[model samples]
Target chain A: MKNNILIAALLFAAFPLLSNTLVVCPDCPVNTIAKGIALANPCDTVLVQSGTYYENNIEINKDLTLIGEGMPVVDGKEQGEIFTVENKYFYIEGFRIQNVGRSYVEDRAGIRIRKSTQFTIRNNEFDEAFFAIYLQNSSKGLIEGNHISAHSLEEANSGNAIHAWYCSYLEIANNVVKGNRDGIYLEFVDNSLIHNNLSQDNIRYGLHFMFSDDDSYYDNEFVDNGAGVAVMYSKNIVMQRNVFRDNWGAASYGLLLKDIFDSEIFHNRFNQNTVGIFMETSNRLKIQQNEFSENGWAVKMSGGNQTNILSKNNFLHNTFNLSVHSAGTDNVFSSNYWSDYAGYDLDKDGVGDVPHRPMKLFSYVVSSTPEAMVLLRSLFIDLLNFSEKVSPIFTPENVIDETPLMTPLPVFGKV
Target chain B: MFKIFKYSFFDLIRSRWTYIYAGFYFLFTLGMLMLSSDLSKVVISSMNVVLILCPLIATMFGVMYYYNSREFTELLLSQPIKRTSIFTGQFLGLATSLSVSLLVGAGIPFLMFGVFGSDQAGNFLVLLFNGVVLSFIFAAISFFIALKNEDKIKGFGLAILVWLLLAVVYDGLLLLGLSWFRDYPLEKASLIASVLNPIDLSRVMLLLKLDISALMSLTGAVYRKFLGSGVGMAISVAVLLIWTIIPTLGIRRVCLRRDF
Candidate 1:
């Protein structure tokens, strides 16, 4: 196996030497990208010069490198898919692809990779694309430094910027996505890493996951989207150092987890979202060291969430710190700093002597009857909450932080 | 009437209670401003104080002033002055003095913080406007209650009751009603109910401006659409005006017919 691996590496090193470079420009003999790809062989390079190419359905079936000089424009004219790759060892970079047409039946994309392995799509710009960079059943691929944007009016008509379906071992990093239906979408995808991406003003979630597992996302900013990031039916996900900000709307949330199990969420900053981190039916999750400031509700836990350990988080000045619909017995909340925790810290141990109950009676009332939220900040409701805090009655009894921090934890580095 | 109004206004302005009220607000606002640098947050905290304190203080002061100056009011009644003008002048004087106390008390600290230059200027102005309106409404209501009740204990008891009812009990009942009839659409019902109560009206109006982000929820969208608009402002202001006018009219009706 060692000899075979050495021979494969040696063949890859020699293959580039035998490859030829094909140029595609307006004045060249090979003018169109389709013509350039058709003339190129395996392990060859197609160098597309800077010019407007009104092309669509450019298929790549060989192991080739397509490099665009000076960021050439590939306008699909709202026609169909562009640069559909079906083979392995493919690489494309530095092209501005735009205007892939929308269809109710077909999922048209700027670059669609299907059943391909060891591919790299880097430094690309996509505008008005229905689906910007789509991967299906592809493995060991890198999607980096791509700027994807679309004016998505509604959920039905718009598509995602980076969509991965049934894919594995993908690295999506340093991309900026805005105004799309979803910034990044993963369905049935596993073992992926998404980082350093800024997704804002999307019509739907910034990042959406469905049935994906073992994926980690960090250092991403999701701002002013319909919602921030949503992970559903996923397991073993690690989300860290992401900033979810200003996602304000009727149903907007910073991070939404549904039916997710064994996930670790830490060091994230949730600021000014309507609902910061909304969890439903998620179990055994470890949430620690996150900072939640000025959100509507710092964390809203719906029914069926169990065994979740939330510790060392800073809940700073959110209107409602926590709203638990039905408290699970095994869920543990410890050592979290609550700005509204009015308990005294005696003995100077850095923890409050009294247990901090994050769930307020008004939040309980609001969860049951949403219209009662209009009474927020009223003197009557303050009295009611105070009385309820003195004795656990309306709000769930189990949703209490046993060791509440006296001051906000210095968890996040910078936001 | 103008002479009486001027006398009462100056008399209350010189009173130590008025100075104490204004001083309390000034110190509280200044302390809040010093505590937090966020002007919007300061405005929100002041909003709660204004909503609760303005009406209560106005109610207490109105009943106390009317009861304390009863002999002087009788001497004025023995003069050639019209009764309507006398009561109307007293009511106007009391409301204006209370409003001045609120404006000076809350306005100075905000001005020291340069609230006019900040983005929270609009919310601050709304806070002051709601406080002033509540003062007028509650003062008029209490004045009318004092005129109707001959007994001092009963008048003070009734005025405090009115304040308690509007400030606290109304919201409790509204919440109970909202939660009870949650199956039905209570948006219009709740809006109308809040509009009917001047305190709730002021609270809702100020809340829509301050906590708009938190209120931008499912039902809050409906509220934001209504209360965040010019029409809603006009309606709330009109309701507050009606709240003030009805009580003043009741005071006038009692002043003309009362045996005192």
Candidate 2:
């Protein structure tokens, strides 16, 4: 690590003195970006001026900076991969890259970083690209302020907007991504920070991570995707202050956690989703101070979830507060404010005197007989739920908030 | 017809049952509101009560009023008033008085609970509107049944039976059919079946607003399009209007044909 830092420091110091500038335009001596790269030496800066460059399969093997002035357009013309960076210490900024060709055999992208470190891809707009920005085994990269979109209607035919695989220490922020298979997907990626991004209208999950650990994502907005976000088989993930909204479908949810461990999800807002938070086999999760409103089901817990603490959240006007498929969960739910709580505070405390149970018998019935959902809000169903509430039957007995707040907890932003 | 309608309306409005029915609803709604702080939930609970109790009460009240007012009807029949006029006036009077009791009973508690200041006001209004419509529909049907049967016991039994069929049995059969045909696309069939039963139709109308997530889970394109659009709401309302008109027209026709 010390040697790597020393080398980076030396290279950083030597870059300004040794680097030369090469201008590329339609009428310039080096007309194309590929030609400019070919003519320039290592550590040089290629300034591509405003022009439509119809090129593809551009490969950079050395450390270089490709800066586009006036937002030059690089139309791949449905050919292939646009920029393939294989060496360390490169920067790509201020370009509009579009129309990377779709391929069934190869995973193509507009900007691909392969085994490269200390790169910055920022201020670029990608339109109709199969994969807007893809990082493979690349570390210490910064992808910021890019607008990425595609017109993909199916998951099989599309790629993610930003896909990181086997990467670490990446900072991805201030990006807007939409209408791809997934807005951002990470696999085997660790120790990354993703914040201040807006991801919406994707064919699949807005932000999806699988087998990725030690990642933190905060202040991001995910809306109207097939499923808002999914964190699967991951550990030690910190999710804070994000907004998940309008993700409505039978199988969709605001956030899905499967096999996740030791994660912290706090201060998020889940609004109008079919299911707000779905957990399966997730353990030791701390979920606090979130606001869930107008969802079909606020929180659904399946089997194998243990030691999860749900604290101080406000659940407002959801159809079913909690639906648990498991017989019991070793989870602690305390101090949450439930709008459906009917208990009184006789002692004049702010909290209710009686413990409030969020799980309902009708939710368990719906879990087993999904078609019975049509009978929701019916008199018979109401009677069933009332009887079940009067007597502890059908629903799990342990899933109760001991200290239910009488009033809704103040949300993050308003406070 | 107008003068007779006014007299009958005032006569029933002063009756003991009207105050009792209205008072029952007022007290129930007030208790529900006081017990539960969630106004939306109270609205839902009231909806169920309105959906079930409204029809049952309307049926019993319709039969009782028609039977008890037989002397008044015979006295009116001896006058120069038309047969259709007398029956239609009494039917309208009974329907309007029951509806007024329902509206005032439910509305006063909701208003007292500050429901008008909340977003749930719309849902509450729909619930009351549905209650009024159900009252009219069940009363008209019971009036027609009483007109057909001279025996008071038979007419009352048949009226209650009709209520039972629509309120509970129809939904049971609908659910059975849906499950039996679970493999097939049952969206259009389910919607049509619901439209056939006035009770189911009203329940679905409420469900469209209250539990849309659960409704949308049934993967039927036509069902989604119909319920998700304004056109579907218009169609459901039209169907309900047609339901009320048909039973009322039947009452008129039976009254004109029957011999006292």
Candidate 3:
């Protein structure tokens, strides 16, 4: 009975000793923020106030909430790697960051996650760092509501804004990425949902997904990038209701598809780019209910594409309707409204009488010799295209839209 | 004299720290390529750091050596020799020390051609140019400082300011130009603007060798595409030469004029 009373007294004494909050102030006892964090437990919250703290290479390796109050900023001190989070089930939110070192040897970031799970990073800002948020060799992460900007002196010197490599099960939503090498980049990522992001004006593509398969991206706007988006070497992808607009360059496009297969591109807008949709060696894509307008070329399909479906789409006011490198047959160009379609709808069902042969001979010649684009809109090229269309000598005979839609579908404008 | 070169060489021979640094860099380059799934990105990235750090190190070393060699320089000047010969010897000695050591250090990783290793090795030629030009640029600057000032910190400050202004701050100025002159094809003007600094030129030429000229397309795309062929490449080489020779000759003239 005496020993039990002593143990109860000890427990009572320790009640007021444990504190769950960390406060960062200039007049505080400790000067090193990292040292203070080291003394904290997993459930503690680190509340840093507004001051430009100069610290370098911080590793966040616990399940704690790092909350910045009143715009507290953590500088890399112009040294390197501001915060590296390799912890599971953590939340890092509400800070401003700047001046991460540029090391070509390592994949450094304002926040780098490795082999972690169920993490959330939101409501932060980063500037002049190599990469804003770097996700590598990790899974099941949520990156949302971060505004990131970067300044790269040279392209070779710059890194991506948000980069995912060899990672899966990501939920990236509602972020604004601007002025980095690429706004958002993914390579070999899978099972991800990218939605509601505004990525624009980056040095390269706004969103670059290469070999990232089984992912779905919807309701994102990619505008005024060096290139819009480069989708290459992937399968089982679904791109729906996204807006690819205003990304213009000499060789830029709304989407550059190379070696892609078995994807569904639905209800997207391709607007005001050099080429609306450029495809090469892509096959078996179901392009449905999409709108292509005011682009240089509505669809520039090279010779290597096969077994694709162009159904229930609208092509309005593009300079050239559909430019093909080869007259690939049985590609199924049906139920799409072409604004330039001039055939009569005599049956009163709003369908054209003549089948539309989209592959003009001049488009093929233009593909072979790009300099012949200068000869476009000329009388000789028109006569040549018409003569070839009448007998179908140069273009494939069966590559035609059997029944063209007379009226465009109501789906339009940045869907 | 050969004695001066020999003495200068032996003077800073205790920089075994350079050996350790070289080993670290070699390991870094190789380790980066191995860890990276995209090997070309590693090389491209390594090239970027190589240019920036290499030039800074060369420049810093030259400035530090000139300052530290006060007594040594005084001893050589006490002899009945011309000041130009001493400066030339120092310049050659500095260039040889930094260039040869960097080549051996940076070249060892690419001895085995990993993925994109051949292109990387091809780009080693450019790296070599960067190292050579950087060393020469510093050597010329070192000579001017070695002639002009007796203080080391002042010379270092001048050199640092110059490199910073040329590489880092110049882009900000270009950005300012873009904002100021919104109507003109200022990007096209930027191509000519890059000619003002050789560091930018080296980066441009190396990127051109990579064959994705979209970056140049905005600024000097017309100039690079039109003359970037044979004659254009040759002219770029000439421009690189101008960056080196003009500065070196100015140092040579200063060495002739100064009564060290």
Candidate 4:
């Protein structure tokens, strides 16, 4: 039976890349995948046609492109990691791979490319594979246009869709990642371009990056994920023109910038997330021209990080413009259009005459105790906010926009 | 004791219907494993499915195995043998065969997943293994129901109902209680549920082993905080053994007192 072959093939990964197209029909040639790889040559492409191909622990150690023809179904049958690719200049596209065994220690995946350079994985679909397109200790890779969905249902059950670990010069774009713990994740990936991806409906963040430095991302859409994008402990990153929307939860954010330094966050659209941007211990960041709309909390500053500029932005329809746990020092909030700002323009200038203190006391309470969300729409919340604004007690005193702009914005650019 | 164990084991194996039930059970398990997506939930949910199957298989086989082997048992009783040994052999045999079939049917597929270090893997193994344990437990319980309850059909009904109550209903009522008292530090409520039912303990043990202790929320926290991993593992194994022993001992007591 096909199940027997699948069970047997799980220990190996070679599904054969011969002549760029491989067909794995029932009683077809080569039920055991690694065996077929011995006959395969470099620069050759393997086409896995529409059937269940059982690949038993085949290591691709040559230059080849593996493409699945006619939506071939590759079942690892819950045995182990299905495909292990170690080839440079390898391109794998268009296969439905499922039931790859989950392992935390192994960092397993449907298609795991380790120490591989300049590989392109596109148009492939993964179902419940722990890490769909996992690049570990690999450099100069392109993981694009892959559709990956894993059902975790429990935290221990799922892994990231696209996980890049210790990989540099990676281009992860145009991928649709969903259902896994995190979609399109990069850990210790350096100098990469992550853009134009649709990552959503995941258990955790749509896109998460940590210890990844000098990476620039723009024009990607993150929607309906548990949390939005999280950039942590990385330096000199550029995040521009991305649409962060519909991530609504108690602990969710449009973008979470934590322990990061010297990152440029510009022209990003943060909508309907719990908090637009949560910055904790991030310093020297240039925050410019971003649009924050319909979010629960626009911005929350927990640590007293310094020298981060917030200017030329639009904050509209968020319940609270900002929440600060500490008197976060040396962060500028100037010339930003706040929709909640009722201050007048006395000199007929575009700028407001009166300075606006954005943070409210209720936000402070909510920051301290999450249970205070039940008191959100009450008069007590309003009274506390008004009292704090009148005298500045609960929130950060120095965190205020000196020149709150009167007009909405010149033109909110596409992000 | 050894003689009785031998006699029971053969009796259950000889019952042709037991083999048929086991075959069908294996097929059903395979069908579910292939068809279901969101495999983790499918695993936990299948516990109830196993519950329904285990008791039915156990009770029917247990009742028929004991009833049909009455003549053979009487023949052994006429020989140089103690009544307790005859009873023990029957109990041991039925429980052993049921456990073996359950393991063969479901346990190997789960292990074949090779998903070590995942909560899903641990959860699934426990779930399927619990089926094996429950088979033995329920088989022993059925012996008492068949002998002491007078009517064979009534004993079968009660056995089925008791299995349902233990496997499913108790947890439902406990959840309702936890949900009702939300803000009352109900984190410890999970431990309460575990202590109340051993299946819940098995489920929790599997989840905890997966290294995903964070998302378990209110009750899981209590378990992690109070009962350490060692304690949890010990408790799970103990519960399974307890489930097996209680009915076997109960059946022996019933058998000793009953006059044929």
Candidate 5:
């Protein structure tokens, strides 16, 4: 036992010799981040101190830990990509990077990880980077607590904040992203988790998903984005405890689902958006325990969505509760609390006696002739809506909440 | 000028039409609020009414007041008051009373609904501001028309015609122009046309503030940049101010030269 202990102690003491801590400073022999990485061995840590390093096209080819002390400024000088990692077990934290050149030919980024596994990127700030953190074929990664911002005046020249392609088993949490083309974009990124993030004021959708499957996002706040969040051509996704607010634009929505299949969206708040949730050609979705308030149109389902269940949700003070373009939609809406429902609960149950019809005739008219929307609040339109409620004609008859709650359901998620 | 303004304001306030107008607004706003049970919807409904009715009422009232008070003004001209002061005083008095009626009438219901404690207070304030500006602009234009035309029938007819041209015809012409120039970049042209008409300008301003979701859907970077930033708001407000000032100055100019 003593011999074994001595051997273990020797191995533990010798491990430090194998992995070195290389310091990079202006006055030191290793001044630049690239130089430090070039001299570093596998399992070595490269420490970068506080200074402005005007360099780009840095390549990290080994499994190394890069820690920045005092928040070093890595100015790409509008040159190119700052960091390109190709090896596994890479960890980077605490750096301020800026000014990566905009290129239409190449997808330049502040940090790009290629086919790397077991990587972590945290506590970094990126400004003016075309693509802040670009992950391609990366698995088992954690991208946490990063702040990315860009002033993208046009979409053709700008890139996304966090662009993930063909990535799996990734966790992106507690990051703030603003003013990019898309805040966080995922393409074919499956089995990932995104949570606790604030994405706002982007030039395009705050969070965009395309052909990504089995992903879950929770506790994320998206506000004032150009087109809000979009989930497209995906399946088996979960969205919960998120806040979509103030995404007010002519073609904007709090959440847009296109060609999506078999998703669950619950406990989300949609507030003051142009359209809270817009679904087109989506199927088999479950939407429950959500709060929709003060939006222009709460949910606009078109393109013949099928088999979606909407229940236990609160529709509070929305201009139009539901706008279903197609007359033969097979979606189910029951046990939901609609603030505009005028039916009474004479039986003393919590449900209204008469089933509440949410789709209005005027909304249908507005869909057909958009210019008629200017007469939205006019007495003529109000009279028309009232008469339609008395006898349904234009609005779809199937889109009714049979078990409508008399009072608003308790709001889901955090206020 | 102050004494003239004070008496004219008091005299108009005591008139039956002011109370009737205020009562109409009061009952309508309160009834809408009670029926809709939503502050924002009520505001929107009231905005539609204000946009169409304020200009019509202002035009008719301005013509009628100027014609009815012609003998009074002649008597005042014989008094020691300056001609400009007398005319300016009456204009200010008419505009101020109309604005007050609008404010008190709409303000009572909005405040009763606890709007001050709500998030839509800013939108409500903008609505009221648009109403006041519309009243001032249309009233000034009508006063100018009345000042230039000595015949009462001609003055009244021309005033209503001006209102019709602005409130309805201008939009029709604008839509026609937009469709005609559909192949060109007509965003700037449409925006300029809206700005030239005070009624359309105020409508767009209030719509931009209240119903932005609908407007933001418009296709064009210029519209987005203008409406999404404070620059658009400033420009709209500035143009509305110019609209108000220029017409009032026109009234002053004609009164100075006219032998009435």
Candidate 6:
């Protein structure tokens, strides 16, 4: 009788020490997710079963693990933000959140993380979210394997997917963001790694950066967006092994770098964009080993870009290879392969004997007067380009590839 | 008219120059098909060649056939056929023969490469249609020029000069005009200017069908709004028809009033 009483006392003492899992279902006592989270302890797990829960403003304010079983639908019913996480050490996985309402005043998101750190938002599906996976002043977050999509009509009325502001050390990988205003927007963010994300068909830029520095994005694809990727007012950016394709429009480009300094863009494939890479006031960029094919303009540099090196790149079949409006000094174009290079190498070297001038007279004229594009493929323009190419007259004389490769470089193997 | 058309068509088809033109196209198209694996790329490359070569060859053939067959044409003029019918039949014969040579020559290689089974079938059809229409338009214009001038050197010179004006000088002047009116909206003006010339018209039409229209739309929203709609296509087709009709009417008017 004494031993039995002591065992009961021990069992009673160990009960609160163990972490409890509260299951939330339609027929359960704890029906709603909010109730389950409310009744759980700080480190407890809230397991939500498969059902459509029409709820909004599900606030999470403690260290908790929210796991959805069989991918439960958390429908916001177009009300407002769905999951507002404001605490640290939180984890959410495998929930289908949808229909956070559009508001002109507030940026409604499916999952809004405010002042949170060390959070993992993984494998969630979001549909019609105004701004999906919004993180403000958050750090050390892992946002992986999320499918965020929205049917954004215009830039004014829509918001971005995976918007991170004032965040650092973010690992945003394996996310498919489509049809949003801007997929993967980062403003005032630093030291983040974004990889293997397919951001396409967004109304605005696929991946956008403003005042973000020391970010490296690789193996990401930006396809058919409004303008592909735009990195503006940033420094020390490393972009490698990304693809920018089919982002075609009046003011579209594969990559737009404005006021960006000390960036490296290498091993990227830019195909079928209006302008492959448009640099404005960007300096000290090392662009190398890229394959630019079938773009309208491969690289269009304008406005005081200095000390940029474009070497060992392959430019094939673009309408206009390079168009430099005001040519910057020390902008080197060396050892690149140009498909339009007609110079031969009599000495049996791989490099051509004559230097190649990629800027055409017609492109120069069209730059000054865009209306002249109506005569794009005219014989007169071809004659003028040929005449100008034979002798450097209108184009900047400093912009020339001295050692153009005779054959195209093998850029596909690295990718 | 049918007899005259048959006679002229058979006579031209029997000539060595017709065979040579057809053979040239066949060899060139086959070479392009063999060289490039991409159908759309081949279509674009062939568009460049067709845009330049179709009008030039049609113009040359029209003037050369008129000059070479002067004796036979004079013999036919003595017959009891209506003047409009004779000239119209001759014009149709020349245009049809040229189109046939283009069709059989370029079409054979495209068919061999399975263009009909490819996604570029629509673009290929547009290309051939542009080629045929260009042949008819240029042939009618050159025939009109040839009939107006009795001097062989003057007629050939005038025909060649007309080709140069439409093919080269018109674009230069258009460029100059566009640059001069840089601050103003020139999309409509440029569209009108291009439609005025059949070569530029055909080139624009083919460009719209190709992927390069993306680049062209960068000029202005007016270009995008106009060329991105069915109304633009209808207007282009109507203008092409007008281009074909007005010159053929000129040919008929000159044939009737002139003293053969």
Chain A, model 1: TM: 0.95
Runs in model 2 deviating more than 4 A are A1-17, A411-415, B1-71, B80-85, B88-135, B145-196, B209-216, B219-222, B225-259
Ranked by TM-score, top first: 6, 1, 2, 5, 3, 4
Better of 2 and 4 by DockQ: 2
Residue by residue across A1-415, what tens digits does model 2's lDDT show? 9999999999999887788999999999889999999988998999999999999999999999999999999999988899998987789999999999788888899999999889999999999999999999999999999999999988888999999999999999999999999999999999999999999999899999999999999999999998899999999999999999999876788999999999999999999998999999999999999999989999988889999999999999888988888876789999999999989999888999999889888788667656556666666566667888788676788888899999998877643
Model 2 lDDT on a 0 to 1 scale:
0.89
What DockQ class does candidate 2 belong to?
Answer: acceptable
Candidate 1 local distance difference test against the native: 0.92
Q: What C-alpha lDDT do the candidate models reach, one value each?
A: 0.92, 0.89, 0.75, 0.74, 0.88, 0.91
Q: Model 5 captures what fraction of native contacts?
A: 0.22
Alpha carbon lDDT of residue B238, candidate 5? 88
Chain B TM-scores per candidate, in order, are 0.98, 0.95, 0.87, 0.79, 0.95, 0.96
lDDT of 6 by residue, B152-199 (tens): 999999999989999999999999899898899777898888877888
Q: What DockQ does every candidate get?
A: 0.63, 0.26, 0.01, 0.01, 0.18, 0.64
lDDT of 1 at A31: 93
TM-score of each prediction: 0.95, 0.82, 0.59, 0.58, 0.76, 0.96
Pairs that clash in candidate 5: A250-B216, A250-B217
**Ten-residue region with minimum lDDT total, candidate 2 chain A:** A368-377
Candidate 4: CAPRI quality band: incorrect
Ranking by lDDT: 1, 6, 2, 5, 3, 4
- Of candidate 4 chain B, the 10-residue stretch with the lowest lDDT total is B210-219
Note each model's CA RMSD in angstroms. 3.0, 5.8, 25.4, 22.2, 6.8, 3.1
| Candidate 4 positional error at B79, Å | 99
**What is candidate 6's DockQ?**
0.64
